[model samples]
Target: MNMSTMNSACPGPFVRRHNPCGHRTGQWAQILATTTAQDQEHFLVIYHDSDTELLPAEAPEQHYEFGPAPAYWTE
Candidate 1:
């Protein structure tokens, strides 16, 4: 795929650097700024030494309650 383009989808030159750690099926994400919206996707720098965290796109506003559902965050 060609990088450094004028678009909104693939912001900037996004590249994933795979760091091998004596195993497979693990990877990280990194981002390098550039003059393009596609560049934002490259902000997540993945490293082997660092632990990557994945969160939901957006947190649920109203959590359904089921018989005193587990409470947290001052629920």
Candidate 2:
């Protein structure tokens, strides 16, 4: 899925693998932002620990699993 085209105004839940930050590499996070760069999509996300990170929407080492945000994740 091309996340750069996704609606950033309404963030959703996503699971990432092999996170470069080396924390919670395979966990669900809330996507706070999505942007395009060099024809590639990136995602800025916040984890359960409140830690935020910017990751590629797709990469050789990282995998993204996107889904709807949980009920508890509300404004």
Candidate 3:
């Protein structure tokens, strides 16, 4: 299969390193999916500690902060 098809079929997790409020709490999060609720988009993410949180999709860079995972992260 083509790269695009493969990616679409099994998209990699959207990972970020921070809290919902855009603060670095020494945690890494993986965005699982996006859902709409009450006319707003939200992201379903799970932290490295196995804690799940729903974050606003608007201005994701600010709400669900994004950055490289810490060196300790391992898949």
User: Quick one: best lDDT, which candidate?
Assistant: 2
Model 1: how far is 31 from its true place, Å? 2.4
Clashes of 3: 0
Where is the poorest 10-residue window by lDDT in model 1? Answer: 57-66
Identify the superior model by TM-score, candidate 1 or candidate 2: 2
TM-score of 2: 0.56
Q: Tens digits of per-residue lDDT for model 3 on 1-75?
A: 222222311223545534435543445566666666687766677766677776565644443335454565433
Ranking by TM-score: 2, 3, 1
lDDT of 2 by residue, 10-29 (tens): 36655455544655666767
**Candidate 3: minimum summed lDDT over ten consecutive residues — where?**
2-11
lDDT of each: 0.26, 0.61, 0.52
Using lDDT as the measure, what is the rank order of every candidate, best first?
A: 2, 3, 1
Which candidate number would show the highest TM-score if scored against the true structure?
2
Candidate 3, residue 41: Cα displacement in angstroms equals 0.5
Model 3 TM-score? 0.53
1-75 per-residue lDDT for model 1 (tens digits): 232342421322223323332232223222323222433222222234454322111111221111221222122
Q: Estimate candidate 1's alpha-carbon lDDT, on a 0 to 1 scale.
A: 0.26
